[model samples]
Target chain A: MPTRILKKSWFIKSIFFTSAFIILLIGGITYRNIDDLSKSSELLTQTYRLNVELEQIFSHLKDAETGQRGFLITNDPLYLEPYDAGRENINYSFAELKELSRNNPTLQKNLKDLNVLIDERMDYFQKAFRFSAVGNYNDQNFKENFYKGKKLMDTIRLKIKGMIKSQNDLLKKTQHTYESNLKVTPIFLYMVLLFSLVLMFFAYNKIIRDLKEIKASNEQLEIFKESANQSQIISQHGNWIWDIDTNTFKYSDNLYRLLGEEPQSFESTVENFMKFVHPEDAEKLSREIEKMITNKDLPFVYYRIIQKNGTIRHFKGYGKLHESSDGGKKLLGTITDITDEIDNLRILEDRNLELERNNRELSAFNYVASHDLQEPLRKIQTFLSRLEDKESSKLSEVGLTYIDRIKNASTRMRLLIDDLLQFSRTNRADNVFEVSDINELLESAKQDLAEIISEEDAIINSDKFPKINVIPFQIQQLFLNLISNSLKYKSKDRIPEIHITYSKIKASDDPEILKPKKPYYHKIIFTDNGIGFDNEYAEKIFVLFNRLHNKDEYSGTGIGLSICKKIIENHQGFIFANGKPLVGATFTVYLPIT
Target chain B: MQEDYINIILADDDEDDRLFFTDAFDELRITTNVKTFNDGVYLMDYLNNEESIFPNVLFLDLNMPRKSGLECLKEIKQTDKFKDMAIAIYSTSASEEDIEKTFVMGANIYIKKPNDFKTLKKVLSEVVTINWQYHTNGLNKDNFLLRL
Candidate 1:
């Protein structure tokens, strides 16, 4: 879309510049032609004036010679008066023509030749007049002198006339040029003026069209600005533009709202805007902006603003750069309200804290429920066992039978209670994990059940156990429970053989395993040659109260495997049971080694 | 379980508990001499008294009227005179905290009192036999750590 606008702009701009160039070129050519035509017309007019003056000078010289001949031969002053005036007019006209033609060396040289002929004619007229008056008054001498003077005057008149005629020919040609000019000037002027007017009209029309476009754009800009303001109000985000050259800032009211301020609440300088930013976030935001601006790139900053109401509102400021004529920078862009985003983050944090607290409570509850609930059950078993121990000696046959039954019932009840605890604690995060040496922790747990372990003739062996982060007490309890359970479920005909081994298991990268992923897990596999279950019940055995054999078959708490499952799960891992009915069970526990 | 100077102390926070315990002792016909105190504070005072009798067994209740059983045990265990006393932790609550804390504090045994009166009636029947001190009869002062 923007490319389309650029293409349109390029097309219009080229048209405008091309038309302007064409009009200017044509106007220049017409103007140059008009100047040359006007200069030539003025020169033609001057040449005509010079020709008329030369003709008058030639007539005056002839008149002055006639007056001198008449006065010297007939002695009349009347004819001399007209000649003297004519002579004066000739002298005045000659001086004026000479001064006018002084810069034209060609015209000056021709005029000088005519002037010498006139002077010779005048001297001849004076000599003829003196010879006719005193030396030879005879008709022959008179005729001779008169004729020589007339011949000299005729020669001077002819020379003057020749100059006048040549000037007249030039005048006729110049006048023709003048007439042609007179015809051409108006037509040329009108064509050029009309063409110029037409061009100007087109130019003006184009300018008007451009003005209209600009006006429409301005109107659209106004509407855009208005909508922008409205949008800022609705969304609490304002946009701004800072012209680098003008050093002016413009922004919508939403910008002020984000700052927890009013338009007039603070000074409208960049420094003033930065002042409202939280001090801690300000440095970070400014640093980002500085890095971007110094490199003449756009900058993005997110920070909090302390509003007038003492609430911290988050804002994300973005800046675009514009360089002034002198290469100074101006940051122009928008500041958006990110208070909701910040609030969401805070809520998430609070929820995580709540989850952690709930987890801790659950762990404590699990431990308490197991320890507390087991106490009564243990006491019941101890009493029942004691009663059974003395059944033969202290009780009648019926009483003996009843005591034995009660002992079995109590032992079964103990197993049920343990199963119930496992079932309840399974869904809870009730395990506290810590980095511990598995060997030492296991030894301590074994010490706790020393009497039973030693009496069972059980051989406990293991590889170098991993020192992993896990719940020490829970893991120890798990070992004791499983070992004791294996001993209790030992095949009546076969001696129980237990093997405790540790191996590395591959970790999963399931989407549910968020955050840092542990790529590997250390597993503790406990294989016992005892009364195992069908492979179909492998998963079921880990469930609460999932027992295959009845009370008569084997004495066992169905929750033993379940407890192991729970403990392993608490350590961010899993447990699975693999066994065959009446064979042995292999309980593999996977614990993440941190 | 013995008549030759086998002495035991029974400390309880409740008067009724002491009375009931004394009745049990009488019914058992235990030859061992018994001493009872209502609170750990008085028990501590008695132990510190010039004419105090050192007992082979000490049954200590956690919640007492004055000075808790744990504090009394701490005070007694710090000294060589009462350090060898076979202290059994008795409490109504069988909480993991109580059990762990007692064990961590070097308690010899942790006992939870039965809630039902029927169980309590049968519980005290063979109490003397499992009193722990009797089991370690051959353990002298120096070999006490190896007995339990």
Candidate 2:
């Protein structure tokens, strides 16, 4: 359908061309008509001149005839002189008329007839004049010549009149033709001029309308280009299209701007685009592009580019293999400047490393302080006890009391140091969590505290426990501390009874118990019938160095529960306690199964 | 043949540790002759001397100023002279790495230095009464590292 419309428009254009060609052809015809009209006018002038010369020749013959008649009657030479001059003039006019009439066949025939009649008349006149010039008296001959001359003169007059009448008709016909041709030439020229003017007006109007349409479209194109450029700059993302088969490249305006280059600075080609790429990245980028094409998969890549001003910038680009409308493979993608993001990531990684190093150093410091500090205190207690035992008899009561105080202080210091060391060592130990039976660990803890349990008369009971992945030593320590805690805080009036029960629970079943959303956990609850503190101090009991009773009332450094809490946390679990005044406390520990 | 009394050797850098150790042994009422050395260097010198009497049991202190207990243990285990002797690592540290290392090096026992003299006496008396042959025959990691 479009082709048909195009053909129709072509036809219309050809019509205009044909009209112009026709106008040119008509103008040529008008020019030819004007030339014909001029030639006709020139012919009419020549015919008129011939007729005038013919009349002159006829008059000269009449003059010669009259002179001859006079000379014959009076036999006078003066009359013969007039005849001679008429004869000479008639000959010259006749030759001129014949020369002018040569181009017209009809006039040439008439001139020939007139020339014959005038010659006969001229012969008769000459004969009469010759007799008069001789001075001879020939009356009879002269009388005969006179009658003959009169008859010949009558014939010559008739012939000359007929010839003159014919020449007058020819001249009138030529003049009419000349007048009509002169009148038609201007009308023909005007018609051709009017036709050309109309065709030219139509062509000029069409051109003006087309020019206006072109101007409007050009304005729209300029607006489109301006908006495209603005959006490219705003996004900091530029597009590129490369045709592999044709080796042609088209880069967006922002792409050139990003590379710090002017538009159209050079041809947009792969090699030219590569020139801006940093030398270090060029080979890799080229290889990636090749791989992308062969693999038929688009991959995102990050690379560095050296701009025209020699500033290095990081760019992230991705491209896909696109089959263009022409069935040729094309790479079309966008490049974004990612230098800021890369720098931010680098800084973040560095900070993370520094933090890890500081944490490790701090843990080491704790371990060293706790472990090394205990040595001196142990020695002091050992020596002080020895001194009191070996030299008590010689020392005064004050000295003995001072020695006992020092011994007590050193022992307390030693306990505190040992507890701190255990607390720090929990974090410093190599975290190797293995599948361990909690029941076995409990039994071992029981054995470790067998003497204390027997001395305190504490009853320890528990349900069957499950196996879990945990650091065995830490977990064992946890069990020992809790059991020992129960023994330490036992009621004076009754023997302590500890009931331990464990049940498996999901994170969803008890959301408040586990912060991390693990699938399963072993919720081991230790309910001890001991001298429990107020419920408000339940959380405080787990804090390091937070004791419910004074050092004299309870023998503990107050670090046991905190170590248990630390151990549970290391296994990604939770430990919490609930206590009521004069009632037993319930300590629950959650250990993830996996 | 069974000896009349057990011969025990202790190598430690601290003066107080040596005194506390010998005092604990004296009060323990054990039939044992206790020998003391200031550092692993002196202990190694005494052990390597051809005329010196080898002890029935050797207690090595780990963190010494010169010649660490680990170095001394390595040297003693390499020699055939100290083959019949029971080696024990007695240090202030109960670190797993130290225990495992000494255990692998064929040390019969590891003892964390006791804080109180009473506990120290009990640990020393228990260690002395143990039949060396039985302890060496049934040697395992569970019964190797002892903490008091």
Candidate 3:
């Protein structure tokens, strides 16, 4: 862009110079032509003057010859007086002709020859007059002298006429040359003027075009600066420039606003701006400014500033060295108000600490539940067992029934404690996920319920399974809880048959997986022929300690299915129970593919 | 007959658990000489005595008032005198952490305290009848926990 401007300026300069040169050429040509015209007129006047002088000389000779004739014929002295006066007049004319023809060599030569002829003629006239004065008109010598004198007069007349012709020819030649020069000079000057006018027109057009472009660009710059100001306000930042050469500063209007002041409210100087800096940060910022001045650059520097209203804000500043085309150095800088960001970071840190404390307390509770709570419950059950084993025969029937009830209650308490511990363990975040075989985990769960399976003669059938990513032990527990749930709720009339099936399914394909977190899931369905509860209790059964049947009919602590739900939740999966009264219960689990 | 009987020691903080341990052993048909300590401190003091006879099997309860069973197990495992004696972790709660820690610490087996007298007697007799040399040779993480 600079180069383009440079080229444009160069073109304007060339046009200006060429137009000036052409004007000068026209001026010179006009001056020379005027001078030539004056010279021609002067030549004409000189030639005319020379011709008149020659004619006067010739006429004077004629007067002298005529005077001699009259004096010889009539013997009058008056004619001789006329002859002397004419001679004096002739000499004056010769002097005038000599001055006029001085610059013309040919005219001077002709004038010289004419002078000699006039002299000879004047001498002959005088000799004749002398004879005539002595009354020698009748004498033969006087008569011969008179004829010779007449011939001399005639020759003199021819010489004067020849001089006049030559003068006229010289005047004509000069007039012709002057006329040709005058004719061509006006056309040449007019053409030059026209060319210069065209050149000026183009230059004017280019200047107009360049001015328009500059105006458009200036308007664009204005818009950009306005937008920059708005953006600075929006983004909580400001800009500044320090000219190193001039030791001066220019702060954008937003910079003043950033300092919580009206634009240009104060002088843009280091001291003036420093007055707003927080006392705690002034010294460090002054040092940084000093370094920036010396180095003409600044890295990120953090500081605090107190506004006029006494509000303190955190600020971060950075600058870079910018060298202008004129080789002047400046530091272009930007400062941002980061008070809100800092406060947010501090708030996040506090929240994180609080969360950590809560987690620690939860883990402590898990430990108490697993160890301390179970210990006493185990002793109670043990002592009750000891009582039954050692003294069952001696107890009355009523006392024995009480003992049995106490035993049932203690056993339920143990179950509840163990189940609560399992639920909390599943809540722990330390479980590591690994790729595990679903069939293997199912087999392990079935083995855990092996005794019950054999005693009840229950048959378990399952489809082939694929490996999936899961918390291994938690998934195994999930399988154990669900299968055992089905087994415990089996119909008294029918043998228990549990069918475990596995398949890959899209989350969208399963209506049960509402608000699916993943696209694909590993679907494992446990279908069993059991004494299923009403469908209304499907969701309720998973609630902790929520049981559909009384303790006399079902031995569930209402915790096993809750533990299963927790385990599935820990894996970020979903478990759904579907049941019908006395037909079957289907527990479908969908684990995310990832 | 005294030499032929199996020698056993149990360290538990609970008096009732100590009574249960001795009672289960008394009821079992296996001929055994059983000893019980109220806590790991008493059990360690007896085992550390130069004149005291090292039992064939030592049952260590994890939680105690002072000097927990884990501390005693670590001390006994380090001593050459107790290297040949089998150690069983007998705890009311069979948490995975305790099971893993005791297994790693060279306990021969981990038995969660059963809530019934019958299962307790069964577990004690089975532990007593185990061939120590054969069991130690085949000991692994899967078999470390006495599940039944």
| Among all candidates shown, the one with the greatest DockQ | 3
Per-residue lDDT tens digits for candidate 3, residues A539-588, read: 99999999999988888888899889888888888988999998999999
Ranking by TM-score: 3, 2, 1
- For model 2, report the TM-score of its A chain: 0.57
Evaluated against the true structure, the overall lDDT of model 1 is: 0.71
Clashes of each: 1, 0, 0
Per-residue lDDT of candidate 2, residues B35-74 (tens digit): 9998989999999899887898888999998899999999
Alpha carbon deviation, residue A364, candidate 3 (Å): 2.7
**Share of native interface contacts present in candidate 2:** 0.52
Better of 2 and 3 by DockQ: 3
What TM-scores does chain A show, candidate by candidate in order? 0.58, 0.57, 0.78
Among all windows of ten consecutive residues in candidate 2 chain A, which has the lowest summed lDDT?
A1-10
The best-first sequence of candidates by DockQ reads 3, 2, 1
Per-residue accuracy of model 2 over A94-168 as CA lDDT, tens digit each: 778778777778777877776776777667666665666775537677567767877876776676677667766
Q: Which stretches of candidate 1 lie over 4 Å from their true place?
A: A1-39, A59-117, A135-394, A411-432, A439-465, A483-519, A523-531, A582-584, B1-6, B13-32, B38-57, B63-68, B74-96, B99-148
The docking category that best describes candidate 1 is incorrect
lDDT of 1 by residue, B24-124 (tens): 56656557677899888889889998887788778888878778888987888887887778787767665555676777677776666653334554555
lDDT of 3: 0.87
DockQ metric for all predictions = 0.10, 0.46, 0.78
